[model samples]
Target: MVAAFNRFRLFHWLLAAFFLLAYLTGDGGELLHVWLGYGLIVLLALRVLLAPTKPRGFPSLAPARREWRKPTWAGVGKWLTFSTLVSVTLASVLGLGMVDNGEVVAAALPSVSIDVFGTRNWLGGLGDLENVHEFFANLALWMVGLHIAYILLFRSKSVMPMLRGLSPQGPGSAPKGRNHRQAPAWPALQVSSKVQETPDSCSFELTPPAGEAARFAGKPGQFLTLQVPCAEQPMARCYSLSRLPQPGQPLRITVKRVAGGRVSNWLVDNLQVGDSIQAMPPAGAFTLERTDADLLLLGAGSGITPLLAILQAALLHGEGQICLVYANRDEVSVIFAGELATLQQRYPQRLQVVHWLDRRDGQLNVPALVQAVQDWQQAECYICGPQPFSELAGQALADVAVPEQRIHRERYSGVEPAVAPPSPGRPSRVQVALNGQRHTLDVQPGEVLQDALDKAGLETPSACRSGVCAVCKCRVTVGSATMRSNQALSDRQVAQGWVLACQAEPDSAQLQVEY
Candidate 1:
């Protein structure tokens, strides 16, 4: 699901190559030009189908908080991209029509008969069509030139993200220190044991047959993507490893029931010891590197799962002092409460556990937090929780003058997307291409892409409809669209023209999307 957006890199490159090839091999190189034109048409159609479902990345053109501020370059880029798509599409259509008129087709070459404009009256009746075709072809060339220049002038730095999927890690952007190998295939693992940590939370120990621990061995703070075979479709969910990996102990993951979570409740109610389930190797960015700096780990609810692993690993490695600020609804809801107490008892001088109960303590006081730890700003901080908890904790850390780079954060629930307002326009048509089939959807003035696609009966990959997951990402080949929010895609990914389909809305009269 996370990898869906990156898959378009090949298509993007191929489209550009084909466009250049077709342009370079004109009538003089009829065969080459003709073949390239056919390929370009197919590719352009695919792009049109993908436009409505484009992956929404971090928008460069987000609106300013103050309404008085002028529009951003991203706003201008939206129109420019749409114009480019329209012009290019026009050019491709005209070229195809001209070829079908038999002007460029040779007797010896294989040709497709698709004369939308009858060839019998080419010069007499089709003169206007030929002229319009030539005009759009020229306009497309100009648009392509301007588009390339715009990217070079303003978004030159984003070239790498277009080729690769990830944003470049600057210094101190959360330490992802573990060297990960290629992800192994999902293997069936038997549930060895289960321990109920709280009324709504439980820990499951899963082990593969003997000699499989090495494949499953993962760094602390990484998560497992579990495949649950539900009654409908197979569902996949990520869970953090709650314990540090050991030689003989099975891999353990903790799960807390979400209010209306289907997978979580199913796992808690249906999973039993000796039952086999599928799981992939661990993967995530919320990991702690072995450092000498004292650590301040903050967690709320089941967010403690990853932090617990980090704490145990740090203790085993003989790191500096560690302080944990764990928050829960009450004492009963605290996961790993006994384990945390045991660790604190064993490392009296090194570990400090501050358990805050929401029922009694209310919100964490920033000044009190600052005063609680000596040299608090100096310690490397890691925070995990639900979206609100993580944000509030991060803000508090900032108020205490902790370096922005020093504080790291992770969230168990997906974050909401951040989106710029739609470029001023009303789009009416949305076309989708999926699994070699094309479907057209009528989009209302304020309708989003996902809704239109749904109404049209095309179900694309999606989780966290808010755009935190890139599962519903598709490519925009024609027209223009805007996303409401996009937390999952990096700025570079946005620059490459990906938009999250779930949050997307057409910005032009017609849009095409391909997945």
Candidate 2:
């Protein structure tokens, strides 16, 4: 689900740009070109604010032809979206250029200096809109017709509110402490305390918070962003889930400390078993195929967590042979060893485990890995671990001709990830609401919100200060900021415009965030 949202975000961005170009060249107001982006930017912002809530109603896929909150000019939103979609399509058909500048122009009139389809212009000496453009023009016309039909079909229902993001689905879908929309308090939820999974990894389970924000949603291979507050400041980080996401079960995370990592070192050295830590719900794209096909699990180091969850699920219910080949620097670095041993003991015939150490094996041999999986040509493979190693293992699978459909992956990290929110420019400050105290920060250029808080002598919860850890995750109830990187977020967040404060900077005059 998270992955789907992430993919949708990419499309929204591109579509937004396209809309801007189309509006600029149209016969409409020139400000439409620039202001449209801002309005849609706000629209994207609203998407986040509104997503947490369920849509009050649907647009009646059964097109209505009646009075449904008029789509006339006063209904700016519907008009903008409909107009943009239609105009772009028409421009595409008329072979109207969408890009500005030489040989390309959008906003007002498409570029027709050289028509792909030989057709005469119909409008004055300016000529026709272009023949190739006709295809898209007709397509747009059909969409508008359909939209109108749907509205008329559902006459009394308001389509505008739905499109504008105006609903919140209560219960079932709204789990505890999972909401990014809720105000941030010292997160009240606590998962099960750390459990030693293997010498290298420890698991932390959680008790999701209450209300519409609580998180009861997660799938195997998904990840969570953590917020760890310090007496003097807060930090954030993102971690992949080692335990699969179950409906009512506690959210579980298995973390492995790496050499020279500040947050990892802190987690291993300072964190207590009973102490509570706040976090965003499990979110990520990697996971195992929840099917009864032959399965292969691969990992180079800690990356084995998500793959383990996948394997565990399959073993408990799935009926298929599961083969796992894991490589590490040494025996000590192999995660979930005891669990694997136990699994092997229980399902001796159905599961296989192969361990390799760089020191003993003289680095991983691609030929050996390829040979190991040669028997399971139809198996689905889930892999995770070190970066270069993950890349190499993925490459090895591909070189050996593993089908793309069969591969999924995950990564573990202490450093801030690059996946931050899409925001405007550097901010001068941020308003933090917590403990009933409002703290204002004077931000420096290139500094994340975490840094500013630290400078203010206020401690907020956080993990990886760089942004990978969501420990410093905050809610922007008002105003906007940019994410340092977006790797840690699922598509749901990037669209709603939630950014990692540890990596984001403000754009508006004053910004407010809930931590």
Candidate 3:
């Protein structure tokens, strides 16, 4: 079902086939051999001349200076690739010079002859050139074999990109006007300030470089994806914005250390002021939907970060009353404690703040949550916390007969679970309408919908391939689908048929979707 064939891939396949055939038929002096040589010459020329015109077409055969110093596996691969290209080119040129018959392929085309070490005869004096050609040809073949083995053994995922001209987890170069949102550019934002909110938690203020603040502007409750440089590879982690968005102000994110959380621990213990980190633009569907509605916000532990932004935004822009139920293990574990107290004092009549410390009040269970929110049952509820607390709050709301559509929950984990590919079976049919084009795809059971579209060469916008970013959201128009996990979409959005493609799995045999 993977069908990402394109002109570049076609050229690559043809050139590979021609090179293999020509190498095998070396020195045959037959019409087929001569024609294959000519084909290789033409294909190689086209590839070299047209590479600059294609998107990221030029291969980085040579490693960068830093890469040479570091000597990573990537740099070694580049060296091997460069060696293969050089060997192939040299062999092809030698074969052209070794051609001695003018009428081998085309009578009108004159045969190419070179006097190497005073040689003119094909077998008598030019035997040395043939030996050299054979050396380079064999070297090219060996280099190619090594490259294939390296890919199969170490980077099996890379083969798909070569065959399809697109990476499985990367954004593709879709045609313009195709309704595909371009991938977010990761720009390095400097850390302007840092604050230790709690013993195991800290808040950092990140400011974009000069003239780029507008790109980071985001609605309250949205989150940013940070690319953390780990020891082995760069890790992408999502952190909710903890402060209200303002022009020319640095964005704020609170990080709470989680046991064995690599990114979180690194960020808390290592990140310093004046350092820079790459970040994607803010994205999430947890923003306040209606500022005018009475709001009941529920949060526990570090989950209060995003809810604080929402509460602040609501208090600043809306006339409706707002109440926040914040739970924590103890008084010292509360993040933004001072700020919340200050806001409560300033807006005493409009904002109600309730803090529940488990050390004093025990855990916030379903019965307790129901009792706490009984007075605010008519308010629109927004909950963000650990899975257990969020689920308990949701259950309490359901017990109170609050409409499901009015309750929204934001749930995410420090570590994402591994998603296995679907078991082999008959795939369901999916009819997708994107950018005025209709296409059909066969989706395997339990397969993520966004991945299916990617294999089919559709370049839909996506990031965080986990369901946290909501960058790959789409609407199902015909059949039904279920999400494996959802941290982005609100209950209202889900009810309205919006599904995050990265998390959606087909629930019916036939379905229709539009982006």
Report the number of the highest-lDDT candidate.
3
What lDDT score goes with residue 440 in model 3? 96
Give candidate 3 misplaced runs (Cα > 4 Å): 1-176, 179-182, 231-233, 290-293
In the range 1-515, model 1's lDDT, one tens digit per residue, is 12334445446546755665667666676566656666677766765565443223212122222212544555454446567667867776666666544544444344644443356443345577768877887787777788778878887886676666755443212223231122224588899998999999889998966676776777788777777886486666778889997777888999888877778888998899999888766655566753335789989899999999999987765346888988888989999999999998887878899998978787665665555544667777888898777777877788778876567776457332344444445557877877677888877766778777777666566544555445566778898877876544544456667787878877778888877
**Model 2, runs deviating above 4 Å:** 1-186, 197-200, 209-214, 246-248, 417-486, 489-515
Model 3 Cα displacement at 220 (Å)?
1.8
Q: Candidate 2 lDDT, tens digit per residue, 333-442?
A: 77778888999999898899989888888778667777776776666777777667767777778877877656765544446455444344555767788766798877
Cα lDDT, model 3, residue 203: 96
Judge candidate 2 against the unseen true structure and give its global Cα lDDT, from 0 to 1: 0.60
Residue 508 alpha-carbon offset, candidate 2, angstroms: 22
Worst-scoring 10-residue span by lDDT in model 2: 58-67
After aligning candidate 1 to the native by TM-score, how far in Å is the CA of 199 from where it should be?
A: 1.2
Sorted on TM-score, highest at the top, how do the candidates line up?
Answer: 3, 1, 2
Candidate with maximal TM-score:
3
Clash number by candidate, in order: 18, 92, 0
lDDT of 2 at 361: 83
Q: What's the CA RMSD of model 1 in angstroms? A: 21.5
